[model samples]
Target chain A: MVEFKEVEGYDSLKSELKSLEKSDKPVFVLFTGSKDSSGKSWCPDCVTADPVVHASVKEKLSEGVFITCQVGPRDFWKNQSNPFRTDSKLKITAVPTLIHWGQSNRLVEEQLFKRDMVDMLFED
Target chain B: MRATLMTAMIRTGAKQCCPYAACSSSRSVAYYSKSAIDTNSNYDLVVIGGGSGGLACSKEAADQGARVAVLDWVAPTPHGQSWGLGGTCVNVGCIPKKLMHQAALVGNHLADAAAYGWQLPKDHHVPHDWNTLKNAVQDTIKASNWVYRVQLNSKKVDYFNALGSFLDSNTIKVTDKKSEKTITAKYVVLSTGLRPTYPNIPGAELGLTSDDLFSLKKSPGRTLVVGGSYVGLECAGFLKGLGLPVDLMIRSIPLRGFDQQCANLITDHMSGEGMNILWRCSPLEVVEAGNDQKKVTWLSDDGKKESQVYDTVLWAIGRQPRLQPLNLQAANVQLNQKNGKVIVDDEERSSNPSVFAIGDIAQGRPELTPVAISTGQLLARRLFAKSSRLMNYDMIPTTVFTPLEYGCVGLSEEAALKKFGEDECEVYHAFYGPYEYTIPHRSSEQCYTKIIALRDDPKTVIGIHFVGPNAGEVTQGFAAAMTCNITIDQLQSTVAIHPTSAEEIIKLRITKRSGLDPRAVGCCG
Candidate 1:
């Protein structure tokens, strides 16, 4: 359910960018450590994100492109959309994130797991 | 000039005064009268209970140039236990319990270190060192006690490490717990705290109360915790975190009188942590399981039978004020028949107005450590330093440290509905996933926030309820808002610290209402 854009080596990120051109939507990518030191692999958080992401994609056809980017060895804050790039704004602390493209193509509405806002996405 | 200086100099109100003999007052004659003149062994103020309230009052009264003596049962370290000062909170209850609980959390965090690719060696486990931790906790108590002792010495106020009881309208009788010596006082402040009692269930003798668990030898095996309180659930969760199998049994929903939904969520989260929950069951009896084991039996609804076997059983049903030994009946002090807590008025004075009670002994709706500490400080200000302002015992916040955390301020939705007509109030709520839960590192639990408001002008935010990460810390600021008469707009203006649990108190805005609800959004996640 939880998805992030994979950025393996330089080629993998380029391929992800190339693949996004065919979609009539915007895809947001995120990277977070998935090791035990972070907490637990089957923690209530780790186990649930996948389903949350999967449900969102399946429930909304109009929803833009969503992808998963598992952490590869040697990841850092070098990514162009790194939250620290601006001015230490957004204060991106923890993950199980829900990042979305904003009104502008280059900007993103990257929120940590917002169950409240997620519920609002699907209304009666 | 006199009025202005007196008002200006009374900053922290006395807990820093010299005793009457040593403290010099510029206009001592103006305030003195035949009745107010001190005689041999007479003091302007005498506070009982060296716990929070008594200690604070003693300090303040000394600062106010009032002769004071603090009579407390500053008991010798119990056999197989430790003590220093800081009363029950520092010595026996809150501080030690929190440290043990936090230690358990460290182990829980270390367990999943592998998922983050940090190759921790096999011997990385931090097995709880009971003796070491107990010593550390005692050291803290000792340090705090020394601080109090030094404060008293500096002020030259009298301090008695003994028990105090009311002998008359203003005089008190004291008997040293260690020695048979007796002393008397002029005016008394009663702040003896509360102690837990066992149920009348058969075999209950085999069960352990909190006082005994801190000295537990072997880790609990198949532990059975009876009571649906934060205490029972929290201990159950902590032991579970320490690799013990636990069963939590309660008569009703855990944390009764709280927001019903939060109670449900907290229990669910505990259950998620692998605890077995047995609800609608009250202990009826206990029997020996084996030479080394114990069995607890309970009656479900309509007399159905259920029994559980365990190596350890803990009871967290309730606590009673430690009032009996004080010989209160001799003084005709009113006690709450329902729970045996001494009844006190707005001024913390009993029906016998000369006698005053605070802490757990004084009957109150919520019994929390922070409230007790603050109440103690306030009582000392009025009694010791001669401050006139009294504390209002309303809108206090409390948090239960169950595995799944939750707490609230002001009235709960159920209580609010009863106080105001249900139709005349509004409830705004938000149920969402926590950003923390989304991280690949935490548990898969979502958070819920609920707000209660009167359906009137300003839509005043009267009650706030939260069940999630740091619920206690989050609700503290919100509680201040309610105390300060903060309207919905002022609360809106209090800029929320982003990515923090506290921010949830303000982030909620115009939310979808059930009907004519006037309340704003509730930030819970």
Candidate 2:
């Protein structure tokens, strides 16, 4: 029998870039959902793109810092929202987005994908 | 530091790895790794849902020498995906529904048995022992299940009787709805098919869904069917044919977004079948009328509540994925929040990358059984590395099993009109009564073919919607054409077999209503 540690949940503040300041690790932040009025290309995981965003982060940077920001129906699950911001920083847009935040909680880089593009994204 | 990780990922995805475990993770890492790593359970492939896709996936894997297991929840024997192993299309959904409707259509022919100058035996009162007929249908399902079980046994595939859910990516939990067993595999193919949705409407539970109605006992004296789409029409129509007084209520317009013209014709024919149609009406509640009857209360367009006395209430609104108990999340598979469908890549991989899903669970564009079967086959071939490339999902066609029957390949007129514009779109329609019914002048013998082609680019037939006789069976070949991206000219140039509803496809011409070049559209000429 395997004894696994229960994954704990985070308290809600608001999911902003600044939330990464709390953790020492430089986290990979992913924002995902429907297309905005500005007409961004969309991938309809609808609201469920939250876990997907984190999964993609775990994909490329397995041990790298990882955090998630979601913009949709406000009744976000207990741990699914951000620790700093609630409403979106940018107007709501495409899904499964990977936003790389560097030290000091500043935005570093971000990207979206239609199919398998890990090679393209991470390749120097 | 980031640059190094990025370069590593790039090289990781592109560089060929050794045939050992780590490189095996790249080649078979997606779904197969889980299947491959599970040594406790001797089976490499164990499919839980015996619907069309499940059967195809398991049977093919077994053919490839993988120890396989297939489980289904269908009772009186699960014949659906078995195809004998063929799956639901042959056993329940398509085959039996079409056969039942065909039997009803023959009712019209029996009326004219004397016109052909044949000596009448007891005035052609066709014997329809409802109990006996129902049993006969169930018998076919049983025999098909037996055949499937026999085939799987011969092929050395374990056939379990249970509903299979995920214990983990590599482990499956099978509950016979009685006994439960947990088995693990290296890979899992989730193909548990869809079931009718029971939305939280008042008295919703009182009504029977299509599954219950199909295997029902005594026919209701009066049946109230709610839902405007094919399921509603089919259930009501079948009940009416079985001599049940049927009233069909549609809250919205009929057929929802089907070709407006075809929807209207279907409504007309449903009324002609002695089935009452309550347009712009919906069931609000259901109450009991003694033990054997039900009182269905419905509201009209004007918001007036009317009491309806029905012996049975069949709710045929829509179908949603039946994946909750399947425990996809345990396997790191994610389902679309807006719909119960799963998130899948073009190859049908879940976000986890260890599992693959198809059919209702795979959350692709189409949700028909045939679509599921196609995806299952494609996934098997791709995962096993048998195929050179992946499956194409464009232009998949499907049909409805209504009394008048409707089949559509590609886009509808409404979608076409929206995409291409009314001015740019054209429809070629042909009307005919099958020659077999024409001599006696059965005017309702109305069968029509509709070909939707872009006006400027008329050579490409974007959609083909056929209604009337043999719509389901005849549409298959045409659907195959559309799957291959067959143009209008290609469809027209094909030789047609005569005295058949399929011939109407080749007989498409400029509709009596509108524009075309001087040349007739049909190829036979």
Candidate 3:
């Protein structure tokens, strides 16, 4: 069985990850920029990568918990000391970063737009 | 007296020079002519230092199927601090220093956050925690040490955690804590690097060197950094950035051999950032004060005596090659009388054809890690893989990670003017503000860049210097361009990455010879 979780910010993502830490199934996480009231993300690359990543995750992940994370607003992200960038475990340099949680498998920035790389991240 | 001291230093393997040019004593020559011992050759190569140079040479030779053994040992500093196998750079020098610099940069960003429209609670200020920052830096260093160890093991290179002293040109005496062994190689390499030197003053042992600062158990309170070497300035810069009261004392000009104009700008920016710089000063003595403090007494150039108590005093006077224990005399290796480092030919070959020296221990070579690594690999390739490419010592890029980082390649402005006369050289310069600094209204008075070239048609770039954020990153591509013999016309013709500090180099037009101001113009200029 597969489960899906949507996380809003870094704090809630930490709590959500804590609950999934002991799950037997694998975990996949996709981090993107937060959307506005019009549902348009401030990051152009994330807006372009969202549907492609979500579709690839649904098609390739047969039995893992897929996590869709909204990192923060543009202002928060621009602050060089933001938590997402500073956290040693998740030193995310840019949004639209997809990770095969707990593994070194990751696709960052434009890598998320490549269908083969996205499928490989989910399948591998 | 100075000549006597120089002769004694040469005999003892210290790099201190004789004040006079009268250092050609017969006694020094007699010291290194020890008779050779008979031994059977056991390996193709034996490297005596496990630093960047030695490790790279050993690994490259091993990859070429040469039987190699690396002997490395870290002697404790005066303060009893010792580290693992990756040498001064990974343990005490670059890695830890850059990480700490980053920590200070983070503090600056946090201070600028409010101007970027980020809200903070009233009266909410977080003090920098030295312990946390130290732990993070140390962790990275530890991991690198382990990785280097694993890499050596996987490469099939014999690793000996012991001190190697030369018995002859081909034989080495290796000694560990509990065992002693003898090994011989067809060729020998000396890359022992250097150690920080303390001034020849009374009670000098009380001060800490860079080797001991990285692993200090507690925070360094109000600090006094002695000397104006790049090491001294960098230590003072980072300490001040971390919100500590730091005083930098210099006996002469800061960064003696670098571009003096750029060096002055660095000092000026640091002064504006609240670092107290005491110029034309030299320390005479250091004595312990009560309650974990030391008082430094000094005489200024203006004939005044001054004393101040500091919780930490760092001695970054200079460095000496770690050759004392190696017993190079037994191998008949020659040392330059002027500077006590090993005398090597253009090919890095020492006085003895079978022996070589690289990195800091080699005379007249740039004491940089990348230079060491590249030369080591090239030497290994020539010796083991039959490659003929020589390591080019020209136009090598380097960065000093200060509060306002400085990165430069090729000759300095002074060197360019000296090499090519003032009438034959041209200098293009600019002082510009970074786009990111606008929100915080940060001062960009010291964010500067310079390009030096010949005044002839299609002037060949002789040098590039930049002092701004991410100076190293900005100067790297330019360094590559220099290697290709890039010309000033090509630089001007290339389109630049918009709104970047780096693009300022490509867009440079105002020359120092021109009477026009070199300050920044508005956007789209």
Give TM-scores for every candidate, taking all chains together and pairing residue i with residue i: 0.69, 0.70, 0.77
lDDT of 2: 0.63
- Please give, for residues B302-415, the per-residue lDDT of candidate 2 as tens digits: 889888777888777887776777877788788889877878777676665546677876775576777777777766665443453566776777777787778888888889
Q: Per-residue CA lDDT of candidate 1, range B275-311, in tens? A: 8888788898989878679988888877888777889
Encode model 3's per-residue lDDT on A8-81: one tens digit a residue.
98999889889988987898888999999999999999988888888887788789898889998999988889
* Cα error of candidate 3 at position B103, Å: 0.6
TM-score of chain A of each: 0.46, 0.39, 0.95
DockQ of candidate 3, scored on C-alphas against the true complex (2 decimals)? 0.02
For each candidate, the DockQ is 0.01, 0.01, 0.02
Stretches of candidate 1 off by over 4 Å are A1-124, B1-37, B74-84, B121-135, B289-292, B444-446, B510-512, B515-525
Docking quality tier of model 3: incorrect
Compute the lDDT of residue B305 as modeled in candidate 3: 92
Query: For residues B368-481, could you state the per-residue lDDT of candidate 3 as single tens digits?
Result: 999999999998887666666788999899998889999999999999999999999989999999999998999999999999988897799999999999999999999999
Runs with alpha carbons beyond 4 Å of true place in candidate 3: A1-124, B1-39
Name the runs in model 2 displaced over 4 angstroms.
A1-124, B1-41, B74-92, B121-127, B177-179, B444-446, B456-458, B493-499, B511-525
Kindly indicate the candidate among 1 and 3 with the higher lDDT. 3
**Positional deviation of A4 in candidate 3, in angstroms?**
38
- Cα lDDT for residue B509, model 3? 95
